[model samples]
Target: MRAHPAVGDCLLALSLLFVDLLVLLSQARQHHGQPWYVALPLDVAMVAPVAFRRKYPQVTAYVILVLSVPHSALQLGIGSATASCVALYTMVVYVGRRQAALYVVAQLAVAVLQMWARWAPGITLIIIVLIFALCWVLGEFVGARQAYHAEVEARLHLLETERDQAGRIAVAEERGRIARELHDVVAHAVSVIVVQADGASYALRSDPAVAERAVRTISDTGRQALAELRRLLQVLRNEEVTREPRIPQPTAESLEDLAGRVRAAGVPVELSIEGEMTGLPAGVSLGVYRIVQESLTNTLKHAGPGARAQVRVRRAENLVDVEIVDDGAGKARALVPAPDLPGGNGLIGMRERAHLFGGILQAGPCPGGGWRVHATFPVRLDP
Candidate 1:
């Protein structure tokens, strides 16, 4: 098994202490009259304090300073001085700046005492000051680097958390788009159904043939609505109806049938196409069909019965313009703009569709009488 970090640190301190003890032993052997016993205890006392240098830096530094002052004054060996430098380095790195300043002052006081006792202001005092200053400066540099790395790690974590929140917000906005698309589909289908059913009811007794034709139109319109609904639901399902022929999405051509159904429901709707609609991209084409369909739906509701509506699609080299206009003179014209009261979902959906193609939409009361919806789309999207 690998040694724990704290265990490794403790062993490193003990190793430094053993090295200082060996140096003291050697110095005592070389210098006669020093005595091995006195050197052994003093050297052990000075170096052993380093074992708790980081854990209790201020206390350990004081202990090492106290042991070394007497040992250095007596000129017993170099071991005490070496251990003092190591303890001061540990103190400055771990005990904080204010305590380090105090430790430095205390060490300088000991040095002055030694100078006065020896009566010699020489190279020894200068060497001790230089060694202590070097250790404290090195410790401060190491501490600053560690603090910088810690700050960088904190900033990176904050950025990651913000990224996660942004992703969730994007997903929520997408779900809202899908919901709006579903609403447009259902609203358009139900409007056609209700109109057709009313006509069939009125003509049921007076004109059998006319009523039968209206019922057939109703059946066809229902089937088309079901197909559109199936396409919408496929987005949520894992199993797709691959066995059936893929349903064709609405395009410029599809507007012809849409107009016919609206005309049969007692609203006179005319669809006019200009330029090259076939060359437009699928997304832009769908955009054209949906905007016209929604506008016509709003017209039938607001324009009421016997109202005439016009849908125009004009394609240019790089732009396509669509407009739907009607006269607000029908029976239900007053009730048609109910959704436009405030925060209308229909108008909101149409505007969002125009914005999806980087297009502009203008919708409001027309100069003549009824409402008008006009949108412009870029024929070719930027690469």
Candidate 2:
């Protein structure tokens, strides 16, 4: 029988006490022994502690086993001693296996001595053995259930940890992409603004009209910068639908417009092209446009007043070469290292953009005291 405290203990205690007293009365009548009154109180004493089997299982089991010997010796009811079996079974099922086994051995010894003292019947001995077996089986079943629950809990915990790790990895990847976009937008816009501001400042006293043109370029560049920034921030905030209502991006064909703006700022720029430039990929074309834009802006800032810049683009079978050279005595002045000038993040940004498309960029003073920027990009016009 399963050993549980709620229903099992109460039922077992009541049944055992009633059966023991009834059996004791029948035996006393047959042998002319003591009356039912005396055995009834003793039987109640034996079954009373069974109720506490779950709360203090080992202690209750031991007490019931010890008391069973004297109750059986006194020829009390048969069911009075059976209540101990229920308590012992409760101990084995609830307590640990080692303690349960020790309890079983102690109960067996008490049973043997009681049976010998009164020469108990065969049926009574068989009942005791069955109780011991039942207790062992119940103990094993409960232990298996506990182990299964633990295994399930451990697997659940492992899956939750993996889920959290994946979420962190996703967040890190998103942050990296956002950082690259911001770098591209800010670096290009800031480079253009710095160049136009410098040109306007230089032309203020001698050529007020040229200075006014440079200031207009500054305002246009600022507006473009704000638009790009808004696009990036909208993406960050997950508002992509609203940003779709904004202006489209500038492409390779827009290079002439870019060159016109630089010329309007009072810089003289000569543009030349070679090979079939019509079929370059969008990414490569955008890269070329940005490189040319940044190079001309740098010329305006560092090449001094009245400097001349040449922009050349040559396309071959698998590669494109771009060169921006300025012929001016301003190279020495640009190299003088003005502490107030912005740091070299613009140059770093250009190099990073080139490297991303599998290209290389070189910028420095030429042997004849001019500044030259040369870049090479691999191009795939089609898929």
Candidate 3:
């Protein structure tokens, strides 16, 4: 229901002009001898500047104060006092207190000169002071309220920005976690299936039983990979929360079964544990298991014929250590560093897992003609 500022100001100026016209007509009817020519010009000049009071507050106010001097000397009717009060209020609200104080002083000086020149009553001065004081109070109250609203709006905007930033950061972290999980599941299973398929292709003519075993291994590996994939995809669903039980994530104790699987894929993995791994935190246990899993999977894919790996896990009082080493017999040349290659994130994914649990991982060609990966994570045993 609020109008534009300029339109409102124009309407206010016109209303004041109409009131001044009525006052002039009344004075003329009462035979005060105020001529229309002089009084009409004075009234027009007084109210005209008010239309632009908010746009050029200080200038409009000063112009009105200057004109009030002549209007008072000429003994014009109530229009002079009304215009001065409006300008004073405008200055206080739009300009500021310090400037408005100066305007009030100038206005008081004009009032005193007019009263003395006319020998007006003391009560007249008292009424004028009260009216101007009222205007000043209104300006102060409105100005303070506006400032409070502005401050509250600014704070709300800042809080909204922080909330949006936090949401984006959380989403990015979840995506990275999912990517690592997918890479571990898909890469390990596909490598095993490819190796078994190649072995089956050749053993079908020489040994039917070995071929059948390789085919069976391929079938099991595929099913396991599909189940892990489905579990990962479920996390991305947006359906209402349900109480469906989840498959438990593999931990450090599951490394024995992992080693047996790698041995079936033509890479013999010897796993050794030095200390108790019981009651380890879920995140730390998962990290240790993944680091070993990725290392042995790399050996299966790149380590040449006759390659064998050793996996050692040591759980200490405040930390867990994992080391995987394989004799480098992969391909004619040692496996080329694939860190920058597309679809080659085995090392990257392993390092990310370790760092997520406050750990460090190192992977490279060992000095004694093999590949070695070592990782250590800090953890506290649960009582």
Candidate 4:
């Protein structure tokens, strides 16, 4: 009823039984040796096993082969031929080629014995062999097609799994990049604001003019920080399509601007450049800028009061180099924590930026009582 194998096999068996019944009716008219009632039961037994050929191919084929003998002995027409052929095809497709080959040999042997005993014609034997051969060929072709489809389905599933893994990896990389950007931007801006705020509070009644400049520096730094934050948030919100003006990312050339800001925040900074810092690839240039910015922020935060920082940039034919050095002396100011500690996020970010671009960064205490940060990068990156 559901169009299943058993139902289909049962239908096929019924058709074979109908053909057998017609053959028996004709034999009875001729007054054959065995009565129609006697051969009918053998025909039913032989043909019924064909219905379970697919479920139990080996057993069904052997049962059909054995029952085919008595059915043929009674001169039952077409029932042995039709049922054996169907069983052989099922054996080839479901069981295996070698077992089917043996089964076919056995079927041929039985047919030969039956014909030899009856002294049948050579043409009938040839016809029986040809029919069984056709069934084997059809089984081979269909089995090959089913195997090919199964392989294709397996390959498609593997590709889909790999594609999903790649998408997840890309997402993780994007999140890491955003986290590094936020750390660099927020850390530098907050350091400058805190320094200016402290200076403003101290100079407020001692020197109103100095205090006024420091307060103005705090306001400017906060505004700049807020602007950069909005840009980051806009990117997160996927709003780049809007017509709002966008600030260009800072690059190697912005080191002078960065130094000037630190100078304005009550520390002296000397910036020096000996290379053509232009036309750098965007990622490399940005990495350079961030490394320097983080290093300078550490200087402002950790290098005590009278500490002066010097930044030097050099460009070789195929490389760019940056170095920041500062004396730890704060001129009797409160002692602050040292810079470039092993576990500091600022130091780690700088190193990760350098490593990302196939470069190296080293930061530690100078030989002559100061802190030094140095980084080097190649001009061209691997594709």
Per-residue lDDT of model 3, residues 1-383, tens digit only: 04588888788888888988898888899989469999889988988898898899999998988887877676666556777888888888889999999988888887888789889998988998899999999989888887899899999999999999999999899888889888888888999999999999999999999999999999998988888777777777656214455667778989998898889888988899999887999888888888888888888888877899999999889999999999966443245463223235878888888888888887776655778888999998777
What tens digits encode model 1's per-residue C-alpha lDDT throughout 1-383? 13454565467556756775676667667765356677667656766776666677788888888988877765665656767787778777787888888888988888888788889767878887899999989989978886798899998999898999898898687776667666677777788878888889999999989889888887887888888888767655646755455667788768888898888767898788887667678878887888888888776666776678999989877899999988866333333454233337877877887788799887766645677788999877344
Candidates in order have lDDT scores of: 0.76, 0.74, 0.84, 0.84
Write candidate 4's Cα lDDT for 214-279 as tens digits: 989888888888887777776666567275777778899888888888899867988889877788
Model 4, global lDDT: 0.84
Model 3 lDDT, residue 149, Cα: 90
Clashing pairs in 1: none
Candidate 4 regions exceeding 4 Å error are 1-83, 116-119, 238-247, 329-342, 381-383
Model 2's TM-score against the true structure: 0.53
TM-score computed on alpha carbons, candidate 3: 0.81
- Per residue, candidate 2 scores C-alpha lDDT tens digits across 184-266 of 55665676677778878889999999889888888887887788777667766656756477655555566777777677666
Candidate 3: worst 10 consecutive residues by lDDT?
A: 333-342
Ranked by TM-score, top first: 3, 4, 1, 2
Estimate the TM-score for candidate 1.
0.70
**Can you give the lDDT of residue 277 in candidate 2?**
64
The Cα error of candidate 3 at residue 97, in Å, is 4.0
